[model samples]
Target chain A: MEFNSRIPIYLQVIDTIKKQLVTGKIPPGNKLPSTRELAVEYNINPNTAARIYKEMELMDICYTKRGLGTFATQSEERVGEMKKDITMEVISQFVNQMEELGYTSDDMVKEIRKRSKR
Target chain B: MKYLQTENLTKKFGSTVAVDGVNVVLEKGKIYGLLGPNGSGKSTFMKMVAGLFHPTSGNMMVQGNKLSILSKGEIAFMPTEAYFYNYMKVRTVGEFHEDFYEDFDTAKYEELIKDMNLDMNMKVSALSSGMAAKLKLAATMARDAKLFMLDEPLNGIDLIARDQIMSAIIKKASEDNIMLLSSHLIDVLENILDEVIFIKEGKIVLSGDAEEIREEKGKSIVDLYKEVFAS
Candidate 1:
């Protein structure tokens, strides 16, 4: 529940749920934690947690039912769709950062592979 | 929506310019820390925004509308010093707020009042510093305002009471509200602040995402204050 300062919190919340999905900590159709619970766990304002949930709903990553909590929305097939979206975005950021650090794509790939092996 | 904004806001006291040329934009549904040393113009700036003091120049806006004498109800400003009529009981303070703020949540006030274990019959003058502070906080949080400005909210409360007050404050933040708190206790607010605005010598010296400032500035906010305000 630790929050990062550099990025917007809503985006982080989205990424956290996405990570949970990929890691199998939370599966499709599983109920997400309540906003108050998340707020207390993270020591964040409840409003921020609510905003995160609202944004996730907008992205089709989650949905809410009246009188029920929010749930992960991506089906097993759509899981791959989410993965592609996240992977491309993450890769773009990594590539840009590596370029700024004077590393080529081959070097970046080599370093990432080395890291993965560890 | 940006719940609050200040345009070239300046406040003067006699010959001294306590606040000068401050421009601020605070979006709704977030918490902001206003950090400054004593006499750095933080209180003065907030006072102007709260309509407690008139700005010598510039303007303050709440929810995209300029704050005027007519628009005071949208803001709830809690001053550092607690004041109430000496003869009045604690319950009277709650009742007063209920009468004043149109959005006052009476049920919430009663619940918080019960949680504090405050005696409704206790007179304001008879209560100790910590008790008075708690009462003030309870009343302030009970209001359903668009913006909440708390100045030095933790000043005199003990550590245990401090935690309770913090939880109370956290509970108050909802999707419809924003909170601006000024405190000298950097470590207490270390993890709570979404963003921090640092003031020095009546001007904004630094302001940004709190964690980014900590990581990039190579120091905690306390250290930054010491360095920036160091003689």
Candidate 2:
């Protein structure tokens, strides 16, 4: 994936892994690639890839087992919460963009309803 | 221990100082990018570090030892241009290194060459530019040296070969080694560099962790390089 130059790369890494999780491409309890493997795949420092895991683990998106590598969290509730959070983030950007385009909340609601009818 | 250190290192060729008063510290386990435009002294500094050229004044230290025979054994440098005898075959070069360097690994060199899909039977003059680049990188990475300096390893390599070469370099890197790669390909190096030192007019113009620099400047390394060297 081509990362944005403006944003920090670790955050972009987190976004990619989270996107994979939410999309079910990497199912819960699945073992993700090791940091070294991630580094090679993305052509990043192994330290940076390790940071990606550390960030995810802090969010409960993934957990590590002693002697074993990291695995995606198996908590359905947490996954559902994450899904909602991602949805809200996208919706926030969309609404903010529409507001800037001279659309009121009511106008957005009507437009959403009309679009939903299709 | 600091993997490599230069104390006001200076190198003068006649009236021109190729590398001037460079002071940098490279620690083990880190991948550093020595970036600059042409004539910025990137290669000159690397050559000094590699012991290919003598400094006119000041000094450098490798593992607390001055630049000497022992330090030469500890540093592996792959210059931009490929240097091989016309009659030398692919495997012959591997054997040459194996005989010359005590740290060279024949098995690893063969494995790398095979992985690179290069024929060991072909003469050095017959291989394509990409193949030769891969061979040079593979040979250097096969060494168990403290530091590896690659000067423009991606100079004429294609996109697919760039990935292959980068992967090889990353594989050889460890917590006990430091790899310093110089390139004008800032975009490609930005992703892999742990630290970056931007040189201009034989001086370090900017030096920092790459991601933090990006966040702070709101610009990519390429953009920063252009801004720094804009003429």
Instruction: Give the residue spans of candidate 2 off by over 4 A.
Output: A104-118
Give lDDT tens digits, candidate 1, residues A1-118. 5555445556677787787786678888889888876676656657667877898888777899988988888487666687887889888998999999999888988999989966
**Candidate 1 chain B minimal-lDDT segment of 10 residues:** B62-71
List where candidate 1 sits over 4 angstroms from the true fold: A1-33, A47-67, A70-118
Q: How far is candidate 2 from the true structure (C-alpha RMSD, Å)?
A: 1.9
Question: For candidate 2, lDDT tens digit of each residue in B68-93?
Answer: 89889989999988888879998899
Candidate 1 residue-wise lDDT, B1-231, digit = tens = 677788889888898989989989888767889988788988888888888889999878876677865567878889987778887888888888888889788788888877666777789999889889888988888888888999988888898778777777787776678889998787677566778898877788888876678778667676777787785
Candidate 1 local lDDT, residue B213:
81
C-alpha DockQ of every model:
0.17, 0.70
lDDT of 2: 0.89
Docking class of 2: medium
